[model samples]
Target: MSLRRFTDELWSDIEPIYAEILEHPFLRGLTDGSLPRTAFRHFVEQDSLYLRDYARALALCGARAPETESVQAFLSDAAGAIAAEQEMLAGFGEELGEEPLSQEVLPTTRAYTSYLLAAAYGGSYAEAVAAVLPCYWIYARVGEQLLAKSSPDPLYARWIAVYGDESFQEIVRRVVALTDELAEQVSPAERQRMRERFTVASRYEWMFWNAAWIGERWPV
Candidate 1:
């Protein structure tokens, strides 16, 4: 009998979260091109904020990696991919006539980034790898789903297409493979922590979209 891959188990734990993400009105709007402009703008702005910190987390993962190749992949290739994604988000800001750099990071965005940074700084290399996996994996999954039926709004279609790009998916696949390989070296207890971190990140994935959909802001 063959053992199940660690990622498969991680995925099974978050299947419900992924389902909710698919049903989210924000994503639904992306599919039908009916998402409000305000919400999309909010998403782009928050995403720009999110990516800045996410790049930092990726760098930490690189610094913490046991293998030199993993370190190089995270520090150079992964960081470059994030820079490209940030550029894409910047273009969206340009088209929308908004300056994301000037905007406040919403509650969800702050919480998610803080969680990732804490994981990277305070947790083990294995935990850091697990914490970052959901973002890469979930977006690629959503992108694949969105690609099957392109959006009518050119902007939304373009955004969906960015995530759906074969190149981006390849990057995500690399991360997924890395997660599985890392899991092999850890103890079962550590693997459990990895699972927990992956689940939290997955929930945050849903919350991030929901926050934009609802125009989440500081409740001052």
Candidate 2:
């Protein structure tokens, strides 16, 4: 389906979740780029683990999925996509004399892992596919705002640079389009249920960052 149609379907699934995200006091700062650099950095560190698991889970999905060709194709294409999302992070990290990629996964990453695992198991491949859309879409959206945030530390600049770059928008479009296609299952009611699931998932999306931002004193 076209991107607009995809957006229509995706909107049903994610709008409620997006609404919850908007209500988050912690993420509210993100609208205008007021989040603390320290918190944001910690969040990025946590994402390293999240991305690793995402790739792994996709790999599992590709392996077990009935149409291994299609599943493998998506996973293979997504392979190394996020890690190379932007080249600025390493430069910024180097400015801080830090390494961008780390070898370990943290507890914060579990939120994303649990999310994908649940969708992959509880829902169909299409649904699991639908559930994964926001990660890419929201990041691209958040990254644009973050890149524009004033006076970012060079380190953070590295991270935000990737999100703001227009090149990643295509990926977002692809994922969103893919989700809408996946949503074309049975009925509007089922689609609405998917939206509800998406909203619940979006809440966790907020908590993942809220936890990192406030370090476990995360507010609901």
Candidate 3:
């Protein structure tokens, strides 16, 4: 079976969670333009922080990949991620007239980034790829869903367009293909580890959106 099929099967186990995410008030508000600016601002800031670390993790994956093609693909993804972060910053700056660098990283953002970095630095290539897949995969899914019922909010619409673009989907397809190829070579035990990592990261994707919805902070 292809890695995409395996991922789809795994996603079926968590499809309910993704459904919940789609129903999240924050996402709903975002799609409808009812989300408070404060909430969206918080999300943009935290995501900017998240993407920096995410790009680093992708770079680490590139360095660890065995094949030249895999290395090129991962490195390209790292660059693309960074570019997306920059675009987000610029878009938010124009919309909110605030600097992204001025915001502090929230606890949820920190936890998510730390987990991804640990996986990238310490886990096998397969594990690292699985760990990062949800961000790409889930965002694309969310984007397409939102785009289908697109909001009149230009800010939200612009955000949706980025993830829903065919280019982004192509990137995800390449990564999924790479993951399946790697899955074929690894031992059963290692494959299990990859699945575990994928599930954890998928949960983190949910938590990230929930945190923004709640405007979560370090309570200490």
Candidate 4:
């Protein structure tokens, strides 16, 4: 099967989870402009935390990449992730008067980043790529959907625009293509492990948003 088909099949397995994410009150509120500012603020702050580690993970993937082109793609993605984080910080400043450093990392933020970083550091190269794919792919898909709805809130609209931008979508497509390419190089067992990593990361994406909606914090 072509890599696109493999990617599509992987997504099919997680389509129900994606559906839940779309129907989530946080996302619904975001599209309708009824989401409380506090929740969005929390999400922005946690995402700021998540992005730094995410960039590092991408860098790790770059380091592990066997080909020059793959290395360049991973590095470019790392740079883009860092840039996105800065943009998120600026958005928070404009919308909530929150400084990136002023926000503490939430538990979910820590857990999700830890999971990704671990995968990047310890998993095979294909698995590392797989671990990171959901973040890129899911946001692109959600952005397109949100753009079609077109939020009335400028903040929400700007957020959607960032993800829906053709440039960012291209990055997502590149990563998906990379994952499919890497999938072909690995053995069947390794491919299964890659899928497992993808699923875990995908689930983490859902949890990250849900955590923001609830304003998750340590019980202790």
Residues 37-136, model 3: lDDT tens digits: 8788888888988999999999999999989988998899899889978888887767876454446888889999999999999999899999999898
Candidates 1 and 4, the one with greater lDDT: 1
Q: For residues 1-220, what per-residue lDDT tens digits would candidate 4 score against the true structure?
A: 5335668767987898899989999999989999998888888888988999999999999999989998998898899889888987875557786344446877898998999999999998899999999999999999999989978998888888888889889888888887878777889999899889989899999999999899888888
Q: List the global CA lDDT of all models.
A: 0.90, 0.61, 0.86, 0.87
Off by over 4 Å in 2: 1-6, 12-37, 61-73, 81-108, 148-151, 187-190, 217-220
How much is the lDDT of residue 29 in candidate 4?
Answer: 91
TM-scores, in order shown?
A: 0.95, 0.71, 0.94, 0.95
How far residue 8's Cα lies from its native spot in candidate 1, in Å, is 0.4
RMSD of 4: 1.7
lDDT of each residue in 85-173, candidate 2, tens digit only: 23334533444345454444555566667877787677766666656656767778767656666233444555567667887877677
How would the candidate models be sorted by lDDT, starting from the highest? 1, 4, 3, 2
Better of 3 and 4 by lDDT: 4
| Selected candidate, larger TM-score, 3 vs 4 | 4
What is the clash count for each candidate, in the order shown? Answer: 0, 1, 0, 0
Q: How does candidate 4 fare on TM-score?
A: 0.95
